[model samples]
Target: MTAVIENTAGQGTNTGRSFEEIAEIIGQVEDQSRVGVCLDTCHSFAAGYDLRTPESYRQVTADFDRIIGFGRLCGMHLNDAKGELSCHLDRHAPIGDGHLGLEAFRNVLTDPRIDNIPLILETPDDTRWAAEIALLKQMAL
Candidate 1:
């Protein structure tokens, strides 16, 4: 089972706000091997974990690896944030059109560490999903 971390800024509860928190929750599970995390790019960025540039991406991902083993990353929600860095907003823009440019998506899509998991899109505007998917596929190759 995979647990998708939710944003805590807008919400009253403080569940899954950081990698440490998520890791702690997963660690408590009886079968941690079967439980994994689903990272949402928008929510993460909104929570202050930047994934835009290579250096920032590396640092943030390293932090994630240190806190919540990369092997436990089972899935991802690929979405650009409409809010600025550390804005604490849950708004999701279409891939490449928001604060997180196409480069961010490119970085994640091409990363070998997360190559095996599914990348689900949570961007707004259902009409542009086809185009977004196509664009991401193109980037993946």
Candidate 2:
């Protein structure tokens, strides 16, 4: 439980290393077992990986491919950040309430590679699961 909590809290806060930078560090290991980049909308937005526009989304993804090898990105922790990209604020808003908006979620869900991975929500209210899940479902391809 402590590990889970720590990991959750740790993820919410930017560890300073960029996604690609983290992948490089992880790649230094001898035996990596299908390492994947998990992008929390909050962290990505807070870290400056803007996905609000189509061109911006493509550019960000292209950069990700260059820096970390897109194949290594195996999962996503979908959450909306309360701050603008690069702000580093740790607040998490509901799916569409934050800067990401609904289109960003739609764009992510359409990606064939990412579609099948776990899109877990670590939002503060689990009771709102039904509505959040529905919103995510609507974003699905």
Candidate 3:
């Protein structure tokens, strides 16, 4: 299911509705198209999903499995979060300097399950991209 939160600002407001209601709508959609989750780090962080600490990262993994299912997660846009956890602020910075630090991203890159997935950094600058990619390469398992 291609689940996009309808209200851009009020992202969590969908929680008010029951999961069945949400599932019903998703069921009606025709195009299966091998549904995949786009893990936009900025959006996940902005929408109150913490990917910083190991425990938080584990929680996020579990939540993704429970809510969206791991089957759909084929790609990620790995940008740095500019604001603090649960801040709901959607700002993107260079890979390592922002709120979601390089260590956290290193941990993510090391995860074996996500190793095959495409991780494209939508960070600020080309220079930052080179640095981040180098950092990622160094950290890769």
Query: Pick by TM-score: which candidate is best?
Result: 1
Query: What local distance difference test score does each model get?
Result: 0.82, 0.69, 0.67
lDDT of 2 by residue, 63-113 (tens): 878877676665677777777767766678888888788888888888776
Instruction: Give candidate 2's total backbone clashes.
Output: 2
Q: Per-residue alpha-carbon lDDT of model 3 for 19-121, expressed as tens digits? A: 2333344456676453445567766776666778888888877866776566666677888877887676667888878888876787688788897888888
* C-alpha lDDT of residue 86 in model 3: 66
TM-scores for every predicted model: 0.90, 0.82, 0.78
What's the residue-level lDDT of 87 in candidate 1? 84
Q: Which pairs of residues collide in model 3?
A: none
Q: Which prediction has more favorable TM-score, 2 or 3?
A: 2
Q: How does model 1 fare in lDDT? A: 0.82
- Model 1, C-alpha of 116: deviation from truth (Å): 1.0
lDDT of 1 by residue, 1-141 (tens): 455554343334657878888877877888776777788898888888888888889998999889988887778898998998888788889998899888888889888887888889998899999999999999999
Model 3 weakest 10-residue run by lDDT: 1-10
Candidate 1, superposed: residue stretches over 4 Å from native: 1-11
